[model samples]
Target: MESLQKSLLVTGGAGFIGANFVHYWLNTYPNDKVTVLDALTYAGNKENLASLEGSSNFKFVHGNICDQDLVEQLLQSGEINTIVHFAAESHVDRSITGPDEFIETNIIGTYSLLKAAKKVWLDIPKEQGRQALEHRFHHVSTDEVYGTLELRDPAFTEDTAYAPNSPYSASKAASDHLVRAYHHTYGLEVTTSNCSNNYGPYHFPEKLIPLIVTNILHDKPLPIYGDGKQVRDWLYVEDHARGIDLVLNKGRVGENYNIGGHNEWHNIDIVKLICQLMDQAFENDKTLIEKYPLAILARQAKSEELITYVTDRAGHDRRYAIDAEKSFTELGYRPQESFETGIRKTIEWYLDNDSWWRSLIK
Candidate 1:
């Protein structure tokens, strides 16, 4: 059977998960067209999608999702039928320090995109020669929206109540509500996926996994928050893309799906794992010592010595776990990468692509 061609407007496509999703979609469906709209913010890196610039099926637009007019123009002109909304102010630390950006980008920006989607896809009257295309608005959200879970609490499911404590998560919760409202009130075709923590290549250095890897190479102290007992579910970025692909293709509208890796680890454990991996990498390949001369601890197979505990952030969630059973049973979705396999690939990527991350660090 011939595949259905999708023209996707991927907001925040220059960011970590967004860029990975763009690559996955284009590579999986070669005939489809993808237009990335990004503001190139501190977290948004164009180099993430640099390789696809010349591809006829790929286009990148440096812009913000808050610009409703611009989004509408792209939707109408490109005849975009699917909108993968990944744009947001995602960092919890940043949200705690400066909540205004999170509110603007996460809440208002999502509102803007929804309005634009509604206008172009629902409000506009189809003109002559215009194809009567079916439209879908897929909102990509985080499991944090379900708030922190207690040690004995069950993993968050599609029915989980919203109790966001952080500004970042609160804003995302609002956006998820808005997406659902648009679908119910105005009859916009929509699907939402709330995913657990994602880690992989091109991840910004500010995030945990990347931070540990990069700081190790720089021979800097690895900061652990509080007791580092905070538990989080980690999903590989490619697996996240695969979950989203299933949602876009097989998911039902007006429904929400949870995508998780089922791999839960304490923050401190993850740090130690990365440190062990680094030490092993350096011991196995003597040349890594030369490449990362500053990683003195890693060279001696003692990277864990750099671990340092810092004061915890305000309103830090104790745990977040996703029960992806709904997505698994309904859409036949399952994460392909085990944390063991994924972390190795992530470490190798960082080691191989020093230039890509060095630019961001400095």
Candidate 2:
């Protein structure tokens, strides 16, 4: 596929996966312009995009996606041809505790973006609509919208029925439906990708991987909810970003794609792997190990002892896996990082960038 000149608006570009995509998009297409609209919520950190602060190709706008006036203004500036919507309240635990934000951000925010896109891209004349034909709205979503899979059930496919279990997943499912409805009803050029669990640099410590890494560093108990047997298909964040790029450029409009690593691991297994890696790192460099408090160092030396089980999360899914064959067959997409390589890299990133995450912790 020929590369099109893309001036993109990346919503929620300050959050974990969104921030990574902003960096990825700028590096991959240096000639393209990117404007990031982020609300700077707790999960959205301006520092995530600090490196791109002065880049000519990048601009960061502080705003909410639900603000229809702001979204329409940005789109009508005629500078943006693509809207990559990523802003959402994505944590399941937080959704259980407080679901209002999930509905407002995930459902209402997505509706606002879609409505604005329709007005800006579809409500114009034939001659002037050439740019609209080239314009695309790419929605990034999660696989949990398909709900859990039994131990022997097949991985989720693009055609899988929506059975969202938590408020977070349900909100995403609603947003997905809205995107599809807009595409079919309004003739809007849109594509959606439901990706598996993503882990990499800039991941907040609240999630499993970074949480375990941080907990181990501090010699705190590694809290495992329930039996830690819940399964998730793990995709490296960069690979997911690459998949998004492929789908945005090459995928058929009005279609949905599934992006995953084809790597499924039990929650406990991932924690244990981090512990083992930490142990090895500490053993290899005693001086590095000494940087931690003495008690932390002692605990880090025997990382497994820190494992502790807690009550399970509400509506915890037993397993989630994705069948990304459609992406591979249609878009020539394939993950570059294996779990072993990706996990090691993620751990090293957290270790090397202490201040980056420490600030978040504070």
Candidate 3:
């Protein structure tokens, strides 16, 4: 790889936000090449990036970030000039069931990447090494790091103290610390973006939005944790990709940016909204009425009927809202879609792309 071309190695590019960022950056920066390294875990599906299969500037590598040898090789031998690390075990419910993978991948893997970067960067040729040092290592993270907030409190700002409540969040916080430590101790050029809940097309099925959509499609009971009052700031996936681009291309190194839309909705509200949208979409589609008569039988089926409260998620955070004012005022960053518009687009995408989701089940 040629460093002059600004190649980026995006870890976990097959996952949800990672895939979005990969597509976003490749299209946004046509001159740059992006190499995606994903372990292809249950959550990491290659189909997400199938759209970029033949592009000259895009390539995918299946691997874990913890592989030191592979990490070192990619750093030393690629035209790789940037790294946007998005690989991690992200689901809090899964983390509660099994937390070991989160520790291994999020924390240790981040350390491995940071170590590789340090080894590659320590020996500068001195004549003109500063330009190469400008290469950015952008860390894609979650706003869950700041834990929950009271309803009346301010949203999480960059200065908000870390208060993780779950295994998943703890692992992410550990990784964030490692990233910050690497920047401070070894002078690695790094920027971190902690974001809110991301919902859009291509999302894996286990998460809230996708899970509900899939369950509704199957006419199964839609499960809601607790009373479904957990408040979360929702940001569109592509908007997140745009924020990542701004942070990677022009952000100040060693800075942390919160990326999220100001839109906040409780979990139940979101699920209800999904049901309403699905009802509207289904009513409009004559084929849906013919394909599934239950949908027509319950023409007035309220979205709320699907809601069933299960046991509250263990270690569930009460609320997470990001104050993206830094990303907004500083980087000239702004999301093009509001939550309403973004959700509608997402619902439409899922309806149009049936086979894409079906293929992922196996």
Q: Pick the candidate with the highest TM-score.
A: 1
The best-first sequence of candidates by TM-score reads 1, 2, 3
In candidate 3, clashing pairs total 2
Residue runs of model 3 more than 4 Å from their true location after superposition: 1-5, 124-133, 290-300, 359-362
Name the candidate, 1 or 3, with the larger lDDT value. Answer: 1
TM-score against truth, every candidate: 0.97, 0.96, 0.94
Q: Per-residue lDDT for 161-236 in model 2, tens only?
A: 9999999999999999999999999888999999999999999889999988888888788899999999999999
Q: Give each model's whole-structure lDDT.
A: 0.93, 0.91, 0.85
Model 1 residue 354 CA deviation in Å: 0.5
Candidate 1: count of backbone clashes, pairs at least 3 residues apart or interchain: 0
- What RMSD value applies to candidate 3? 2.6
Which of the two, 2 or 3, has more TM-score? 2
Worst 10 residues of 3 by lDDT: 291-300
Candidate 3: residue pairs that collide: 1-79, 2-79
How many clashes show up per model?
A: 0, 0, 2
lDDT, candidate 1, residue 89? 92
